[model samples]
Target: MLLFLMSLNFMVLDNIIMLEYNLLTINSDMIVMTILLDWMSLLFMSFVLFISSMVIFYSEEYMYGDLNINRFVMLVVMFVLSMMLLIISPNLVSILLGWDGLGLVSYCLVIYYQNVKSYNAGMLTALSNRVGDVALLMSIAWMLNYGSWNYIFYLDFMKNDISMMVTSYLVVLAAMTKSAQIPFSSWLPAAMAAPTPVSSLVHSSTLVTAGVYLLIRFNFAFSNNLMMLLLFISSMTMFMSGLGANFEFDLKKIIALSTLSQLGLMMSILALGDYKLAFFHLLIHALFKALLFMCAGNIIHNMGNCQDIRFMGSLVNQMPLTCTYMNICNLSLCGLPFFSGFYSKDLIVEFLSMEYLNMYIYIMFYVSIGLTVCYSFRLVYYTMSGNFNYISLNSLNEENEIMLKGMGGLIFMVIFSGSSLMWIMFPSFYFICLPLYLKLMTLFLIMLGMFIGYEFSKFSLSYSSKSLMTMNLSFFLSSMWNMPFISTFGINYNPLKLGNFYYKNIDQGWSEYMGSQNIYMNLVNSSKFLQILFSNNLKIYLLLMVLWFMFIMFTLF
Candidate 1:
């Protein structure tokens, strides 16, 4: 721990010294920064460090009996380093390089459990991530071919032509996939195969936030069709994930789905061009989510990896410290007043009011928040308030001292930093902070969710499992309206089938067209030069061609 602090101090000192010497200057196409120091980046970096340390500390105790402690420690440090680099990156390419490193490390860590389930989950995440990575690469290639590779490239692409439109759509698709937005949201819930500490780091604090960060950073490109796409995608993702979380039985998967839901909310806020709200929510979500995942970890570790909350009950008595921390974190998740979530949640709604079309979005956002409260409270109550029916595998059952201390310290940090940092970031938030009526409204919604969750606890399932519920009713309802204005309304709903329908019914003049093309095909096929060019000696042909050009040049001289 001392060595870790010293390393942090050295990085800070290096950055300070570089700034003092004016060693890092802003390019003409770059945003000015004092050695790339900015309030937002600094704040995000602080969260990364805090959470990474807590997770490391937690793992020291959580994995004490496992043989792979060294491996875990190495991956944890690499994770921290990669996130720090990503947070401070000054250019898009540099940011992407950092992001790739982060994805690689996170994928490796998610499967650290080395079980079949974890292995499959890790592969699924990597596969989805590869799709996003390819999209990003294509976008980068397009941007470099047209606009400059500097920061101005994003600024210049807003009014560019058709290519820019295609590139922008591709980027939005990639961002949604990376952030685990709807349709691509299944990977995250399955990612619960990871241990709780890794889940906390990836889902809550670092990698999942990358998509929102990219969207907010590239708001200059939000002008064209991209804005509408983001709004729809974000709305659908939030609405669906909220319902998904409601039905999930695993304690970890519930939080995982909630992460996707909250990320969707942040994306929607960004779609409205409210950068502050998006970033503010990112910070608050990171805190509460990290705390909650750690608490879940504590519960699971104590129960010898019994993941279903259906079997966990009356934990408040057996694990008072974990319960207290869980309650506070749950309150934050529930968005109770004076907690961290309250400030950010309210601010986002206020920002929504400023947009014309955003009122409906605000309604949906609040509904999702209510759902968030419901799932969060359900998670806490089900795992802590029921009868203690669970049996510990080890007779001398207790949380590791190191793990408890780590978790307790993280909970304290969340409480302290959550409120104070909000004030520091946006002092204006202090005055317009939810009015008495709005506070009551928000509180009422939260209480309604708690009531539902409380009622839900009375009815128990005979058998419950952690994998995500096979189907989501809310998702079906929300997506039923997405047929593109000509399918169910006037055209075909199945795009692929439409292609086959066209081939079967249209273009009956195929033979005449083929006959006309035969002469051209024969002329090309009869060319000896072309035949030679297609031979394996194609490289030699190219060499002879170059020599002929040289001979022609000599004769002219």
Candidate 2:
């Protein structure tokens, strides 16, 4: 909170402080530990600390009676420390230390449960993030050509360099993997295998957004071509996650998918060359999304660890406080006019309206926005309305005051952070003039999406239902367009197949026959022959020698 106050003061005073500790100097290069204290870093740091603190408080009630509570708390603290390192560092080297720390610690959290599903999910999360780690390392290597590892100092001047351009591409690739964009997106939903508190902290603000923050930091170096490519991928990610969420049944997975969708929105805005808007959305998103997860956690806790929304109904009657928090977050996530999400989301859409983007991007942007609303309303219809469909023996109520209070800290921010952030982040309003139809397009899409949600919420697996007719398509969307399969078995198939072939033809087959095994057999045969000659054939050898001498004399003649 003090850091947040300091950020406000820094913004008001327009101040930046840099402190460098010179660690080692080799010729013209110096290895320095750099700390940049500006509104951006301070504000981001403050938000991390705030969300992490809230998540910890929420975990108290959520993880109650767990045997490994101390270990869990320690892991969460280390996770926050890693994010703090990521937030404040401008150097690629130090950022990577934090980046890897997040991957490692998240792997620990993801497999927190002693179950096969958790183990699989942890492996998926770790390996997916490994791609980004390698990319960042390659970028660090690329930056070495500039005589320094401090990328912040060289970003502007090094833009024209070929090596730096390659670095930019690597950096973007790294961001994509970390942000779970398109091909790397399977991990985000899978990571819901972790406890909900981990999801609140990791998905909402820290682990996933690290990519966005890194890209925002490097936004100055991107070419137009790269920006267009990034826009396409991010837009697709937004569309994919939103569509997937509608078909999803798991409460945590649905929320996780929504986080994926919002991340795509942020990445797209950043791709549009508006980092502040992305950052603005990032801060507001952290508040509400964190609270959203907390509400989901409370519900899951009361439901005896059940996460399927299909089994959840009329939750408003039993868990009124939890339902209230969840509904507010749902509305905010949909970007309703007065909510915090609306401030950032509305400005982004309106701003995009003014840009000269192609038809594909424009359609993608609007449709994705609709899909986001579509799924949110569907989730609301299933979980908040209708009759209770869960187990008859279940006890559902919001008696956990710790969880409620934790969520309460963020609930106000969820409602007001957008407006407050807009006031501070954008001292002057943007002058965006567009056609009335264009201005109304976004509102129209939101309404249409809500209607679709209502309709879809009525769908079922009954014999008469038409949804079964399109079962394949529904399965595709619900399964993330088969992304998990593709990322898992599909990705591993050819490599594993090749390995099998090598094992048959080389490692176990020809190599065994002609290499060590073959040589051993040959040596054994020769030894047997020598042994026979020396031990048993001595008398026969004398007779053979006399016969050989006679034969040799005849041949000589």
Question: TM-score for each prediction?
Answer: 0.75, 0.92
The whole-model C-alpha lDDT of candidate 1 against the native structure comes to 0.73
lDDT accuracy of residue 145 in candidate 2: 92
Q: Model 2 over residues 1-557: C-alpha lDDT tens digits?
A: 89989999999999988789999999977779987788999999989888999999989989999999999999999999999898888889999999999999999999999799999999999999999999999999999898777788888888878988999999999999999999999999999999889999997889999999999999999988899899999999999999999999999999999999999999999999999999999999988999999999899999998989989998999998889989999989988888888898989999999998889888988998999899999999999999899989987877789999999998887887888889998988899999899888888999999999999899676645656658888888899989999999987999999999999999899898999899999999999998888887878799899999999999999
Model 1, residue 282: distance off in Å is 0.9
Candidate 1 ranges beyond 4 A from true positions: 1-35, 152-167, 358-360, 392-399, 429-439, 461-557
Residue 176 lDDT, candidate 2, scale 0-100: 96
Best model number under TM-score: 2
| Model 1: lDDT of residue 56 | 89
Question: Which regions of candidate 2 deviate over 4 angstroms?
Answer: 24-30, 463-469, 507-510, 520-557
The number of clashing residue pairs in each candidate reads: 2, 0
Itemize residue pairs with steric clashes in candidate 2: none
lDDT of 1 by residue, 26-107 (tens): 6654432322455566667777788888888888888877888898889878987877766666455666677788778878
